[model samples]
Target: MDCHPRGRGRGRGGRGNRNEESRDVRLSKSLSYALRHGANKMGLQMNSDGFVFVEELLAHQQFRSFSLEDVERVVATNDKQRFKLCNHPEDGRLQIRANQGHSVKVTDLELRAVALDDPDYPREAVHGSYMKHWPSIRSQGISRMNRTHIHLAPGLPGEGGVISGMRQSCDLAVYIDVAKAMSDGIQFFWSENGVLLTPGDAAGMLAPCYFSQAQRLKPSPCEIELH
Candidate 1:
């Protein structure tokens, strides 16, 4: 249910204005799910560059409130495969598998938690692709930007995966009650994308930054709140 703002993959006229009917359907379903199964708690983490906030809906409080038993009944123990079409990154490894377009390359993977307090949250969602990297960004440019784009689960009973462009643009869905989050006193910020409103700022969103120590340029400014 990775609903987009209808501008996905339309950079410089890729598909700008060419809306897809199926995409619309998917967006609708995702919105419905987010709203229906509102989350209560959020997970936030900090880093050297910025804040990384994970809604923690998949395995945290959101799941607990929605029916922890259900989540426990379905999700895998490791929860590693929760995200779909993962790839083992390598240097200049673009076309490494059959599903290349869906396989994004990345180094120094990290996670964050975002609070989901208000009910209005998980509704005022931002739509776009995110495949953010530092070195790749420097060498490739905006055209080579990869971030979260599509969420594919097939609704096959117990499988969900957030997919994006190779090595970057790995899309994910975060349910947040913006109004309530501010009121409850919690925020996990990355770079000022100017997509948010209060304690925030834009819509020209950036990539899903990956902050790691093992990999150079593993994504700086990737921070999140501790509490």
Candidate 2:
């Protein structure tokens, strides 16, 4: 899943002016793009864990106008908590990484493996998509595409403990049979932000057979039988 933070403006009584808020949003998007998908393309040296030195990142041309504090602000104030800042393993200097939703091959992330028998396993897992893509999805199954994993939400938006998985504007919700998929040897992992992720089969495709049901959530709510 290539999830990026929604650029949310500050509240009326929040810190910083409109200009600062705009800058923060711009910086957040740039960081999201680089850390999740383009660190290598951007020539930033990221470790296997997906961390890049804050200093090195600041030196990039796109961030010349930004500062370390700006990065900290973005991380601290992000509504979804998409980015993480921590000290480098080799040195005391600070580094940053995307929490999840990486297109890059990040080997190490704080993901908890969810077994079928896990007591806390989600009762429902859904992937949100649009009606326009339902035909292709129904035929080809859900593909991770360029992302490392296919992202699923444990529950819909506004539900308790649900955040950062599916988009709010999504009209279709494909419910996955998590227990059935796990019983069939498909691995499921829970990200730090509560997103359910799976690498799928060897080909990285979650076939329609694993989909328990599909529902049209917008304009109206109705069940769709997958053929």
Top candidate (lDDT): 2
Please give, for residues 1-227, the per-residue lDDT of candidate 1 as tens digits.
Answer: 12111212322222223443333334333322332222111232322222122233333432333322222222222122221111223322111111111112222223222345433233233222243433443333222223221221111112233222112333322223333434445343211111222222122222222111112212442333211
CA displacement after TM-score superposition, residue 44 of candidate 1 (Å): 3.2
Cα misplacement distance, residue 192 of candidate 2 (Å): 1.4
What digit string (tens of lDDT, one per residue) describes model 2 on residues 166-227?
A: 88899999999888788888889988778899999889989898898999998888898788
The predictions' CA RMSDs to the true structure, in order, are 21.1, 4.5
In terms of lDDT, the poorest run of 10 residues in model 1 is 93-102
Evaluated at residue 114, the lDDT of candidate 2 is: 96
Off by over 4 Å in 1: 1-41, 46-61, 76-81, 84-107, 110-227
Error of 2 at 151 (Å): 0.5
> What TM-score does candidate 2 reach?
0.89
The 10 consecutive residues of candidate 2 with the worst lDDT sum are 1-10
List residue ranges in candidate 2 displaced over 4 A.
1-16
